[model samples]
Target: MKSVMIKNKYWDIAADIYYPPGFSEDKKYAAIISAHPIGSCKEQTSGEVYGAALAEAGFVVIAFDASYQGASGGEPRYIEDPTQRVEDFRVVTDYLMTLPYVDENRIGVLGICGGGGYAINASMTERRIKAVGTITGANYGRLMREGFSGFDPISAMEAMAAQRTAEVRGEQLRVDDLLPSSPEEARSLGLVETDLMGATEYYRSDRGRKPNGVNRSMFSHQAAAVGWDAFHLAEVLLTQPLLVVVGDKVGAFGAYRDGCEIIGRAASKNKKLVELQGWSHYDLYDKPEPVGMALEKLIPFYKENL
Candidate 1:
């Protein structure tokens, strides 16, 4: 894997490129843009895990950090705007197309967790992306309304309104932890769900922890999610081949339901949904068994489609 930077508007997106075994400069190869989840970075699950795995499977892959977070440049860090999130995929695709060894027509995308929803949403309008896949797909917009545990809708709205206003007045910006500092604290807070528990463990501990994966975000920016929907218009515009891989575990995050909704709505005639029974949402993040199970299907899906 080699680290590189891709231009996005006025800033740069930090990313790592993983070349397939015996890669060649003279040969054009299928490429994939692997996006990490919200509050995660390229070096963790996306770059080192799935990105490396997919590259070894013969596809050149690039794993990148989202803008406004994780080594990427943007003002007022930790903004999770849904619109811009989808656009980030386009920036990555443009950079991928520039490489002489990357086949422009055979590019694909795979996103994990929240990145999954963004991937599907981006693929809807990004015709250059020939195929799409999601593992434990999460719709951040749906999550804010239906699954978010941090704040009730009414309070979240009021808080965001207040914070955004306060920031404009030169008050200190408000940033909050995306999860408890540890699993023990999570359990004490009654966050007993598997996804929540695993999130605290994974993000806060060495299990999946990294410095750039700070697991926090600006408090006011979350308001963008309340009114957004990742699957918006997918039924009409999502024509690329689609694949959704998710665990059977149902939890607060709603990845399973989001996966089902996208599969039912996507216009892709060649789509498929594979369930890894008994694996929870976080299991697909870095766990070998489930990741292996997911890649088994993903490797072939991209291979055949791209």
Candidate 2:
């Protein structure tokens, strides 16, 4: 496995292109572009593990930092913009297409967490991607417009509007601190309260924790809160194969299930909703056993379909 830098116009989005050692460059291989979750770099859990696993499976797996985060080139570092994130996937796909060893026709995408929503969004608009999958996926627009299950749209609007006003006033918008820096802090952040399950372990522990990430930033909340509708064209995935992977023990899993149901209903071909037994939302990020299970399901799916 080797880490390489690929240029996307003005931005040099840092990425790692992993392949089996001594892998031939002459063979045209299936390609996969993986998107990491919000605030996570390409080195994080799901992206790092899956990128290596899929490479060993004889596919060219490339995991890149989303714009404005990590080593990727973009303005307002660590910001989250749903629409631009979706476009980042398309740009990555285009970059892959230009690779000498990548078979453009067999290109697929895997979105981890919020990246999953961006993947779905890209799949609907970008026809080049033949297969799509998500692990502990999120619908960015859905979450922003509606908080959790009984999300208050009015509050979401107020928050976004306030942020927009701050932007217009030339005030430095404060990035909300949602991620915990340590185990003790996780409890205070309400990330792991009482029986909240694996979120605390995921974000605070070494499992999913990163030293440099911001843990919280509402870069897209304002845009998504008012007029953004992520699933508006999800029905367009009817012709493409879709895979939804989620942990069974967290609130995110339910959202994954609901989104899967909607896409499954709209999809005309292969579609699967996988619930990893006893797994929690954060467990899927870097944990080997669970991540391996996801790759096992994903590789075969893309091989057969893409």
Candidate 3:
């Protein structure tokens, strides 16, 4: 694996390229770009795990830090703008196409968590991505507008508007923690116990924590996040082969249901949904067993389509 910096109009994206064993620059190979979850970096979540595993399966894989997050260059750091995130995938695809050892026509993308939504959105217009796969897919827009347990969208929008107003007045941007600071706080907020446990263990504890993986996002990001839609025009534009994976345990959560909805709406005639029983949303991020199960299906899907 090697580190690379992809130059974009708005930021320089930091990425890690995982090369297949005995990879030769003289020969072209299928390439896949793996996008990480929101408020996370390449070193965490599926970016590193899935990228390395896919590379070992004989495909070149690149996992990158989204602009304004992690090691990527951007101002007003940690802002989760869905549009820019979607464009980052396109920029990475452009970089992949320029590589001597990458097959431009066989480029694919695999995104985890919120990145999954961005991947699906990007694939709609960026036809260069011949195949797309998502693990525990999440639509941030929906999540931001309607809380996990169906909070009032209007109140959320009002809060976002107030934050934007404050920003306009030169006030410091407000930040929101991705996970509760403690299990007690999570419980007090009435958050799902399993969701809180997984998130806290992954982001707060040493299990999946990284120096660059901060657990906060700009409050004003709600402006862009709430307006964007991962499945927007998917019925007409998402023509590439699509694969959506989700843990059976997460089906009760909105993200899993959103993934299913996306698949049903996508125009891709080759779309498929694979549910891994006994796994939760966070389990597929880095757990060896679930990650292995995901790669088994992902490898063949990309090989056949791309």
Best by lDDT: 1
lDDT of 1 at 167: 92
**CA displacement after TM-score superposition, residue 95 of candidate 3 (Å):** 0.8
- Answer with 1 or 2, whichever has the higher TM-score: 1
Q: Model 2, range 162-212, lDDT digits (tens) per residue?
A: 877887799776666654557777666665542133555666676666664
User: Can you tell me which runs of candidate 1 are displaced by over 4 Å?
Assistant: 149-155
Better of 2 and 3 by lDDT: 3
Please, what is the TM-score per model?
0.97, 0.88, 0.94
Clashes in predicted model 2: 1
| Per-residue alpha-carbon lDDT of candidate 1 for residues 164-194, written as tens digits (9 for 90 to 100) | 9999999999888888988888888998788
lDDT for 254 (candidate 1): 82
Deviation from native of the Cα of residue 226 in model 1, angstroms: 1.2
The residue-by-residue lDDT of candidate 3 on 1-306, one tens digit each, is 899999999679999999999999999999999999878899987556899889999999999999998889998888889989998998999899889999999999999988898899999999899999999988888887676325676766677899889899999889887787765667678865665577776777677888778878887766778777888899999999999999888633356887889999999999999999999888888889999899889999999998
Question: TM-score for model 3?
Answer: 0.94
Off by over 4 Å in 2: 148-150, 188-197, 218-221, 252-254
Scored against the true structure, residue 90 in model 2 reaches a CA lDDT of 78
Better of 1 and 2 by lDDT: 1
Q: Find the 10 residues in a row with the least total lDDT in model 3.
A: 148-157
Model 1 Cα displacement at 305 (Å)? 0.4
